[model samples]
Target: MQIQDLPYPDPGVPDVRSGPRFLWWLGRNQLGGQLTSLAWGLLHFMAVSAQPFCVGFAIEAVIDRSGARLALAGGLMALFGAATALGDTFLHRTAVTNWITAAARVQQLLARKASQLGSALSRRVAAGEVVAVSTGDVEKIGWFVEGVSRFSAAALTVVFVCVGLVVYQPALGIVVALGVPVVAFAALPLLPRATRRADVQREKAGRATELASDTVAGLRVLRGIGGEELFLDRYRRASQEVRQAAVSSARMWSLISAIQVLLPGLLLIAVVFYGVHLAREGRISVGELVTVYSSVMVLMYPLRHFEEIAMAYSFSRPSAKRAARVLSLERATDAAGSRAADLPSGDLYDPATGLLAPAARLTAVVCGDPDAAGRLAERLGGHPSEDGPSVLLGGVPLDELPLEGARTAVLVQDKDPVLLSGSLRDLLDVPASGEVGPTEALAAAQCADVLDALVQGSLDAGSPMDAHITERGRSLSGGQRQRLALARSLFTDPEVLVLDEPTSAVDSHTEARIAEGLREIRTGRTTILFTSSPLLLDRADRVVLVHDGVAVAVGVHRELLHTEPRYRAVVTRETEEETARGGVLKELHALGDAERLGDNERQEIEESA
Candidate 1:
């Protein structure tokens, strides 16, 4: 099945209902396995109960002095032993199958939800919390779910054993039967405390995981600024908190375990004492007293199941809650009947900022605040947000389109694009299609040098572009990754492309080439370039200077530089500052060849009829 086809209902707002409902949903999905497990558990418990009866019968037969009776009792005991062993084995097998299947289903559901949400998933929930749910929480919930059948069978066995004893030897049987339930249930009071501790432990663990992930992702930057030690110190403190929380949780569980053992022992003692009193009074025979004791001993096994189920539930409840919280994140909603097909394909506009880009125009947006630009880029790409005016494409609201459709129609290439691990070819093969050839896309993004570098560093015995890239393209330089990202977007050939500072990482020459190539390749497509580079802005058909969330000026790049002092100052910071120790013109000229041979080759190609 495809990843999108996996079953994952939109879990609504979390309440007390969410955890129980999720469990119930899982049980319903695996009802057949659950029933099979329950049947086997009952059969297993019955076989176990019969062992005690066989032992008591053998004792009575020995007293009667009948060889035939003794032989029959011995045969019955051996038969019950084999039956009990087989039953227990099958029961455990069936129960474990149920546990694994249930966990797998929950994991599948969680994975599907994560994929559906895409980048939005981490925004709504901590990365660590999502990690914990998929890993630990799924197993805990499955354990509790499977334990239900075993505990039910155990409870039923205790009832039947009690009734049998009451019929055979009423006096001692009543106390033995009544005491089991009390001892098993006595641990309930501690469960709430245990669950609370478990929740706290899980919370702290998620925080520690988030810290670790963040530290690892920013490790290079941290080390570059000599802040690695500071982050390490913070992580160490967080790890200690997680350890303390885990210890606290473990202590509560230990207390519960002690009670599970102690209370059951107390009940066994009470049963033995009562059974002896009845035998002395001649209310029950010696063999029957043996039966009474054996039955109580057998009852201990089932009673243990009760305590185990309690513990399992205590641990799983909070885990289930955490899983539910992630599943419950709301997806962006569109108006009824407003499907992706209805979305228009002309100029994109943002009403909040009053910024309009005519169709097929190369528009440059200049914003003083980078954060505002980022937010605007998101909105322009149809990302859901509460604080912005709606973005429209050809007068149709962009938010009304389906996610996939909107993404295909309008691609947003962020400044720092995420690079997934794969071969160079695989890395550039996002949203996989064959519209843009590899060589052409590379040339368009001015990535020939980047490709050559990758080839030089290839460790595999294969074509360089086919060489495997590490996770997040960590093996490649930052500028190479960025250019590769630009190449990928250029390959997509989206009708409307929004690039946010796409050339921020590259050198001036490479940046200028990229800007020229981008304009040439996307000659007829509507492209929005968000950058402060004069080289890029100079090529744009129109440059819009945004101040305080509104577009204040719209004109050509050179016109804005001459007329709009704000736009000019924003772009040419070094040039405007008189106090700045500007480099000598001769020194600037030595930086690079002003008219490189590569530029001449590109210009010749452009002019070729």
Candidate 2:
């Protein structure tokens, strides 16, 4: 496909059997573009090859003192020169297009795989590896793809030139023809070494990239904990390893390059020496001798493509293998293990946790451990854990439903939801049911202040909705970002919404309002909330106390608070801390009041104090 028609309507299913197989699949998909590039490449190389022949003709005409032949020779030279220019220009343009298009196609496939895998992708693949594949590896792969056609064209031109020389003058032609292959294949022995070194470099580079990514992602936390230097030192070591690997790889390629240069020069020397001998013996004319020399000189340019092909393959093979490895990953049941099932309308039940939230009701789960809460929330949304039967909706396993069907039926918002960079309006725009509007969702999630902040941050914006958000909503406070994310999820209006600590970042006043709004908005839908906040639990229709990993008790918030000591301790820790702080403040105030009192009055109240 052409660049203009890029971002393929469907990137098509990738064949991830191996690196070579994946490369072949990419080539097969873009046969049209490859062929077009090949045609232009052939034209360019052929025109260039004809220049030596034309020069030979002009030399012959000059020697014969023939005006007609001279004029004809000059005309042919001019014609071929123009053809050469035209072909070279178009060939470059087509080659670049092929490169970009192939990269775009691979990017599309990676993106599609990421979407299909969802949160599972991050679990299966390293963030740095994905970043490396998407950024550098993609270009390397595209480079090899574009090089193929050019190399083919160059090889073909060498073949045609060899035949022409042999037909014109066999004595000199045979020597040059035999010498060309030597120059072309002389570097083969070093290619395997170069390729192995390149693989080492790529692997080291990928690890360095991963280290850098991890360091940057947690830079804030590292600084807070005074560990920034520790991470920096670690990253420095990784960077050094990468540099060493790269140098080793470069050395091998340099050796290959030397071979390419050395063999061609030796071939040129051999041809010149043999051609002069043939001319002295009167076996060939002076013009034919010049033709032979010039032909060898022109052949040098095309022969360089051989080395380029080797270098390109060496670099791209590892990149393709990494890409293929990532693409080959599949969710536990997303492969052929599961069949599409109809979306079910019933209670959401996690067999692992033995937690069931009945349909059309707001159920709250009180889990003291945040990690366990997160896992349960994921399960409720049909994302299975490593060692558990998939969550079931009604009686059918959620994993059995088609991916899109499951997503439409259940939405899970983890504690830390990401806010992608975009305008406020675009941020809220998602593939969602039309039941809820952005305004209603924002209001329900208590994001009025967030909207005001957005508008105030960008005064020239058309409206508050037009204000742009920074990546991950870094411009907003933790609570503000959480509310906006909640608003977005609320706008989706899924049939069953599973939230983990949705209001944890906000103050109790805001959290209380959000809990009320949440209950109101999800009047007839199934909503499961995993939190220990009394403000939210008090608003649930029913509360489930999950004590280790399983639901231990089921009751209303107040009932659990009085009857379940474990539940009360888990939910009342913040309240107890606040009460203790209040007591300390009261005693401090009493001491200050007594200090202000007269000595006699202080002594009268001293015993009570």
> How do the predictions measure up, each by TM-score?
0.85, 0.85
Ten residues in sequence with the least summed lDDT for candidate 2: 577-586
lDDT of 2 by residue, 452-506 (tens): 8998888778988899898888778779989999999999999899988988889
Judge candidate 2 at residue 581 and give its lDDT.
47
Local accuracy of candidate 1 as per-residue lDDT tens digits, 499-584: 99998889999988988899988888899989998989999999999989889999999998866767866887734442122222
Off by over 4 Å in 2: 332-343, 366-376, 385-389, 507-509, 532-535, 543-609
Residue 382 displacement in candidate 2 (angstroms): 3.4
Flag clash pairs in model 1: none
| Per-model CA lDDT versus the true structure | 0.78, 0.87
**Using alpha carbons, what is the TM-score of model 1?**
0.85
In model 1, the runs with Cα more than 4 Å from the true position are 1-17, 66-86, 335-343, 386-390, 546-552, 562-609
Error of 1 at 294 (Å): 2.8
What is candidate 1's CA lDDT for residue 20?
A: 76
